[model samples]
Target chain A: MSVQSKPRVRVPATAAKGELIEIKTLISHEMESGQRKDSAGKAIPRKIINKFTAAFDGKVVFEADWQPAISVNPYQSFFYKAQKSGAFTFKWKDDDGSEYTAESKLTVT
Target chain B: MPNWFGIRTATATRRQALTAGAAGALAVLLPRMVLADEAAVADALKKLYGGKAMAEGRIKLDVPPIAENGLVVPIGVEVESPMTEADYVKAVHVFADGNPLPGVVSYRFTPDCGKAAAATRMRLAQTQNVVCVAEMSNGTLFTAKSNVKVTIGGCGG
Candidate 1:
């Protein structure tokens, strides 16, 4: 079964060539660590976004190996230099083999 | 005004003075309290990079000096890197010495990432040092640390 998740990414619409720009990302996830019990005292299987990767123009720019400690609705902010106008892709993988992806475009002047 | 040392010598015994001095020195030397998960950080470090010497600069770890809530503490880490294909940061690992699980998160970056920097929120169990270790593409490691003081609110001490 697939879960509903929304990945959000923020990148500047325009940037000067070679300018470093900040990229902010957030995803809506329950991030169940599998350590907690439900109302019926049943163990909730761990379902967390274990990995995140970002690529610009087919080149991976940033990635992360997440653990169960990551809070719900994982949010991260990083930086990337605008080398050229291209599309930035962000992907998040869950422990249950689910992948959620989002994309944004950058226009380098 | 009376000299500070003269007043301390008048009422305190030699043993008392020595004990006070030792306590003060200990407080300075050992800033962090002993926690059950103390060795977890070391184990994590060993697992990530065994026997590798980690330099103590180039990474800036930003954490609040005091946290109003331990449930959520903001953390930011920035590493000095050229972010070029020839020389860039490979990954960054974050750890909290006092948490039940010392390993917090690890971030990997490529040359396209421009700057080796990241910001996130973490759950800190108590007052402790937040450590960030950045691995360069050339296999060098740089580390930095920041202490956060957590207070249990809503109770009048």
Candidate 2:
């Protein structure tokens, strides 16, 4: 039931105006699917991260749709061409209707 | 030894009846099972790609055709776009047709991104089709798919 995102993300401090750079993100979550059974044989209520998004300087850079099948502590990596230097924000939404967010700075040279 | 004829006649009749029933049932149910998997995959693809209706071949899904691990498989997606204010790739959606839940991930991008690509490790339950869908700047959608044969079962199979 707890949702948290990484405090920082590392992208190259500088890149050619249109150079592609690797971006990595991680979130802290249990990602429980309510379908499983507990010790007492009762169905464990599903708690899963349903969505994720990354934005740079107010523009959307990446987004993801998550399902109960995804494992705990989701990890994702992707690439984006650096056109400017600014802050990238990561956000995640869980099935329990909770939201968690994190941000990192990008320096495009 | 003395009742050989009676035994032969009874056995022959029983075998004939069993064969006739099995043939009839097979004729009725064989196609359904054979086509069920394809139908399920198709249904999922439609849901993922048809949202915007205009599918442009802009999505690239990169994964090994044979994954040794079911617990963790690496998946990478990239779309052809300029990532600029005037136009950019908006979102990317991924699907594993045979996975318990076919929809795996969705990524949204904006103009400042400069480039558009995502890599992540995912779980695969079995050998199945993996699909990628991308939404473009003007609300257009594009899709691509590939079938992967999993050597080791990931989902307790």
Candidate 3:
């Protein structure tokens, strides 16, 4: 990865048991779609975060397969049931086999 | 998809005949503008569903009717489901009719997700319709689509 990638997650600090809380995640990437040509009229190579995954306590909860059409900085949001207090891990896998990860904690009562 | 580019009419050299190899080479040599259309989207759906009939219900698509910018068009999808182990949304696949490719994003949701809903932003080359399909745990499918008009195209070089 030639560019620096940053992952940010937003999870509520507290939730009631059985609460359906929204989890938002965003990452910065160019997401070159390979459809663009450079100054020399050559197609630009596609480099993007192809996969995104969310896990709670090591159990996968939500996953997304992103195509080249995703925006430059991908922003994804989903709902998760807050059963217990745990840390949610978000992973973004890039085309070059690079993985960017971020974590957020939620406390369920 | 097969018509992404047209057959080159360039004069063939003595060594390079108009063979399949040469056609392939010519395809690479020429800069052909390619964009997926409604037919491409239909083909993608057919490939995924394999002729299975998709019922039109329990699915909702949230996209602006007119987008201020094409680079970041916010899109949302929600499928009505219990979110239980026995009944839940298995996956959601999204496609666009007017993009470089029909496939936009695919989502897999587990029971841990209390709601079978997701949102993300995408790039639109022009004004087009976005189609989304959801597969349920019981082997049922649902679909929805919405059109968005873009003021500025986002996929140009």
| Best DockQ among the predictions, by candidate number | 3
Report how large a share of the reference interface contacts model 1 reproduces: 0.71
Q: After superposition, how far is residue B126 of candidate 1 from its true place, in Å?
A: 2.4
Single out the weakest 10-residue window by summed lDDT for candidate 2 chain A.
A1-10
What residue pairs are clashing in model 3? none
Q: Which runs in model 1 stand beyond 4 Å of their true positions?
A: A1-3, A38-43, B1-36, B152-157
Report fnat for all candidates as fractions from 0 to 1. 0.71, 0.64, 0.92
User: lDDT of model 3 at residue A83?
Assistant: 97
Docking class of 3: medium
What DockQ does each candidate score versus the true complex, computed on alpha carbons?
0.35, 0.42, 0.74
Write one digit per residue (lDDT tens) for candidate 1, span B39-122. 788788898899589999999898899998866677888899888889999999999887656767899988877888998777
Per-model TM against the reference: 0.79, 0.70, 0.87
**Backbone clashes under 3 angstroms, per model:** 0, 17, 0
How big is the positional error of residue B28 in model 2, measured in Å on the Cα after superposition?
24
- Report the C-alpha lDDT of model 1 over A74-103, residue by residue, as the tens digit: 888999888889999899998878799998
lDDT of 2 by residue, A1-109 (tens): 3545443456666777778788777777776755456678676777877887878887766777776556667777777777778888777787868778887787777
Clashing pairs in 1: none
* Candidate 1: CAPRI quality band: acceptable
lDDT of 3 by residue, A1-109 (tens): 5669999889999999999999999998989988899999888899999999999999999999999999998999999999999999999999999999999889998
Worst 10 residues of 3 chain B by lDDT: B2-11
Cα lDDT tens digits, model 3, B65-141, are 99989999999999999999999999999999999899999999999999999999999988999999999999999
